[model samples]
Target: MSDTHAIAFVRNEMLPQAEPPVTQRGLVKWLRENMFSTIPNTIMTLLSLYVIYVLLASVVPWLFNGVWSGDSIRDCRAALDGATGGCFAVIRERWPQLLFGSYPSNLLIRPTMAFFLLLLAAAPVLFSELPRRLLWFTALYPFLAYWLIWGGSIWVPLFTIATILLSWLVFRALESRSFFGAIVAALIVFVVVSIVLGGPVVALLDSIATIRLQPVESRSIGGFLLNFILGTTCLSLSLPLGIALALGRKSDLPFIKGLCVIIIEFVRGVPLITLLFVASVMLGFFLPGGVDFDLIIRVIIMITLFASAYIAEAIRGGLAALPKGQYEAADALGLDYWQAMRLIILPQALKISIPSIVNIALGLFKDTTLVSIISMADILGMTRQRIMNTSEWFGVYWELLGFAALLFFIVCYSISQYSQYLERKLATDHR
Candidate 1:
C-alpha cells in the first residue's frame, strides 16, 4: 500500500506539445490583440482596411499600366487608349535634367564622383564603429567636393584648406596661453589669409603650376544636384555653428551671450523665405563693387544661418535637460569648462539632442525646395523650368512632382531610420 501510494504520481514519458489556440497564437493572435482587441479597435481597423483597399484599387492599376515610353503626354494618353494609366514618360524623358539640371553632359562625371565620394566621407561620421582615421577623408571632402562640382583651379580649394590649417595652427599655438585670445587670433589670421589667398596667391599659384577642371558657373548647378548640395552643405555647417551658439548663449561674458541671443532670436523671428529673398536680392547691395558673390553661396549662407538658429535652440534644450549634478561632478573632477563640456556634458547632451537635430536636418533638406521661389533651379525648379514649361510636357505635373517627392522621401526616410537605429544603439536607460 505504501509503495503503490509513492509511485502513483510518476509518469514513464513526457507529454506531447500541443499547438496554441488559433485566436491566441501567431498571426491570428496578433490580429486579435492589435487589430480587434476591442469593439472600437475592430471598427477602426475595418474602416482603415476599406480606405486602403479603395486607394490601392485605383492606384495599383494606374501605376502598373503607366506609359513609360512616349514623346509627350499626348503620346502617353494615346498609348493608354482610354484606359486609366499614369503618364510617367515625362519622368523618363526629363530624368537627366531632373537629376543634374543644366549641368554639362560631359561634366556629369564630376558631380557623379563627388556624389559617391560623399557617401565614403559620410560613412565614418555616421557609423562610429568605422575606423576613426576615415575622418581625415571626411574633413577633406568639402574642399575636394567643391573643386569637383564647381570645376575650377584646384588651388582654390587647396588655398582654402591652407587657410583653415594656418588658422588652426595659430589657435593651437596660442590656446594654452589664452583661450579667448587664441580664438580672436585664429579668426583674424583666417580672414587675412583668406583675402590674400583668394586674390594674388591663387593667381600666382595658377601661373606657377595649374590643376584645373573646366569651370562651371554656380548658375549652371540645378536639379536634384543643387538640392543635395544645399542640403548637405547647410546641414553640415549648421550643427557645429549651432553648438557654438548654444555655448555662447550660456557664456559668462555679457557681450558673447548678448550677441548669441541676438543672432538666435533674429534668425528665428524672420521667415526663411524672407531670408532667401535677402540672399537673392539684398545681399548684392551689401557687397563691395565688382565683388561677385555667387547666388548659390549666398543662399547657402542664408540657409545655414537660418538652420543654425533652430538647431541652437534644440541643443540648448538638450543642455538644459542635464542635471546640476553633472556640472558639479565635472568641477569635482578638476575639469575646466570646455574640457568638462567636451568630455562629459556635451556627449550626453548630443545623444539627447539627436532626435531634435535629425528633425532640423530633415526640415533643412526639404526647405531646399524653397529655393525655387528665388529662381534657383533645384529639382523642383528644374521640373518647372525644364519640363513643365515645355509645350510637350505641359500639365504633366503629377509625374514630375511625384518623382521629386519619391526622391525626397527616400532620402528623408533613410535619415529617419538611421536616427532611430542610432538611438537604439546609444540607449543607456535599459542598462
Candidate 2:
C-alpha cells in the first residue's frame, strides 16, 4: 500500500468509535431510573404497586370468570364457582324499565329515540377534529331530543330547536358580523317558507300524535339513567355554585366573605346524607303548599349545596396557589373584583384545581345513591327494590353492588382521565 494511503487509514483508525447508548437492563435499572428517581416517587411507586395487586386480586376473577353470563339469578350464582361474580341478568331484564321508567309502554319509542340522539350528540364532542358545523347539529339536537323523551310534540321540538339555534346564531354573531347578517336573513326566510310550505300542518300532526301517545311521569324514571341524571345535575349545579361561594369567601368585603365562610363551614361540618335528609323532609314544609317540586330537583339542590362547600375549599386553595403578579396585573388594568377574578386569577386557579375538583365531583356522583334513603328511585334504589322481593340474596347483592361499582368506576375513571388531559391542555400558554 502507498505510504499516504496507509497514513490516512491509520489516522481514521486512531479516532475512537462512539460507544453505544446504555441498555435499559433489569429491575435495578428500572428502580433507579423510575421508582427512586426521587424520594416521593419511590414511595408512590410502592404504594401504586400495593394498590394494583389488591385490585387485581379482587377484580380479575370477577371480570373474567364472572359477571358476563346467565338468565336466572340461580344460574349466575352457579357460574361464579366458589367466588361471586356480578349478576348481570337483573340489569339485562330490567334494562328498558331502567331507561324509560314509567314512560308509557307505547311511548317507549320516544325515549329510545332520545337515547340514540344522545349518542349522536356525544360523538362529535369526543372527536377533536370535528367540524364547527357539527356543534350546530348539536345545538339543534337538545330541542329534538327533549321533545321525544319528554311528553310533547312539535311545540317542544320547535321551541327547543329555536332556543338552540338562537344561542348558536348569537354566539356566531358575536364572532362575525357577516354571519350575524346571514343568520338574520336565513331565519326570516325560514319563517316565511315554513308558513308557505304548510309547516304548521305537520307540526300539528306531530303534536297530536304525541298527545295520543300519553305521558310518562317524571317520578317513574330510575335505574342507571336516573343515576346519570342525578350525578350530572348535582355535579353541574354544585360546581358553579361552589365557584361563586369560593369567590365570595375570597372577596375583600367582610360581609360577603363572612357569609360565604359560614355557609361553607356549616355545610362541610355536616354529613351529606343529613343535608339530604333536611332537603327531602324540611324543605317542602317551608315552601307554600300549592307549589309542589319534584323530589329529583330537591335532592339535586341539597347535593349542589353540599358539594359547593367542598368545592369552595378546593378552589380557595387553587386561588391561593396563584402568583401575586397575576392579581396586580389584573388590578392595574382597572378591572373590578369580578373582572379580575374571571379574566386573570380564575383561569389560572381553575387549572390548578382540576384534580381536586374531579375528586369532589366523583364523591358527589357516588353520594347521589344516598338519595335512595329519601325514596328517590336512582339506580341503587331500583336495584334494592328488585332484590327485596327476590329469593336470591347472594346473587342479587353481588350483582347490584358489582354493577354499581363498575358504573362508578367507569365514571370516576373517565373524569380523572379527562381532568388529567385538561390539566395538561390548560397548562399550555397557547394564548
Candidate 3:
C-alpha cells in the first residue's frame, strides 16, 4: 500500500457525459419499448401498419376522387368515368334531410338554436365546476327545448313549469312531516294541476300573452335530429328513475324491493326490439279511449324505461361494491337513509357506475336506429326512406351510411372520452 495506492484512491477527475444509445432515447426508444420490444409485438405492429396502409390506400383515392357535384348516382358514376370513387353527391344533396328529416326548411333556425342552447344547458350538469345557478337553466331547458322544437305557444311550457313548481312546493310543505306522504300528495297535486291548469288555464294565458310559432308535428321530426332528441331525452329521464329504482330495490320494505325487482328483471328479460314493438303497436291499446298519444312520446317512454332498468342494475352494482364501512360511516354521522345516501353514498356510487351508465347511454343512442322498423326517420331511417328509395341516389349506400357512422362515431367517442375524463377526475386511488 504505498504512495501509488494512496493516489489511486484519492485522485479523481470528471469524465465527460456520453450520449445514450440511439435505441434507448427519443422516438427510437419509444418505438422500441412500445412497438418492437418483443417479437410478437413487432409482428403485430407491422401487421397493423400494413392494414392501416391498405385502408388508407383504398380510402384516400376514393375520397379524393369522390363526385361531390353531381345531381344523381348516374351523374356521379359518369363523373368517375368507370374509376372507383365515392358518390358523395348523395350526402351533399340530402344533407338537410339527413340532418333534419322533414323539418321545415325556413324554420331550421329553431332546432339549430335549440341544439346550441342544449350545450349551454348541459354544461352545468355535466361539469359541476360551473356556477350552481346555471342548473336553473338546465332545469328549464326541457320545457324551452320542447317549445322551440315543437313550435307551440310559450304558455304551454310556462304553465308546465308552473305546475311542477306548485307541485314541488306542496311536496316541500309535507316533506318534513312524512316522505312517502309528501310524494303521494305531490303526485296528486301534479295530476290535478295538469288537468285543470294545462288545458283551459294554458289556453287563457296563451290568448292574452300570445307567443307562438308555426307548429311542427312529431312526424316532421326525423334524421339525426330525431336520434339526438330520443337519445338526450331518454338518457336524462332514465338516470334519476334508474337511481330511484336501484335505491328502491335495496330498501328494507319488501313491497318496494319486490316491485323494483320485478321491473328490472322483466325489462332485462325482454328484448329492446320487443319493447319498441310494444311502444309502436301495443302501447296504444292500453291507453284510455280517445286519448291520442304521440308516437314519439310513447317511444320515448318505452326507451326511457328500458334504459332505466339497465342503469338501475349498473348503479346497483356500484352500490353493492361499496364497503360496509361506508354505510357505517354514514350511521356514525347520525344521518338517516336519504341523508346518508345523498351526502355520502350516491356520489361515490355514481362515480363507480359512470362507465356502465355511459355504455348503456351509447347503446341506447345507437338503438334509436331501430325506430326505423316502426317508420320513424332517424339518420339511418332517412337514408333508407328518403335517399335509398329515390332514383337520384338509389344505389348510394356507403356514402350515406358512412356519414351516419361518422356522426355516431364522433358522438360515441366524445362520450367515451368524457367518461374517461370523469373517472380520472374522481379517482381517489390515484391521489
lDDT of 3 at 429: 45
Candidate 3 lDDT over residue span 1-431, tens digit each: 57776554543887889999998899999999999999999999999999999999999989999999889999998999999899998888889999999999999999999999999999998898999999999999999999899998898888889889998999999989998789999999999989766799878988788999899999999999999999999999999999999999999999999999999999999988899999989998998888868999999999999999999999999899899999999999998888899999998898888889999999999999999988899998899988899988888888999999999999899899988888888993442
Using TM-score as the measure, name the better of candidate 2 and candidate 3.
3
* lDDT string, candidate 2, 45-97, tens digits: 99999999999988776666665556677777677766846667666766665
lDDT tens digits, residues 281-362, model 1?
9999999998868899899999999999999999999899899999999999999888999999988888899899999999
Q: lDDT of each model, Cα atoms only?
A: 0.93, 0.73, 0.92
lDDT of 2: 0.73
Per-model TM-score on C-alpha atoms = 0.95, 0.69, 0.95
Q: Please list all clashing residue pairs in model 2, or write none if there are none.
A: 87-399
Candidates ranked by lDDT = 1, 3, 2
Candidate 1: which pairs clash? none
Task: Rank all candidate structures by their TM-score, best first, as comma-separated numbers.
Answer: 1, 3, 2
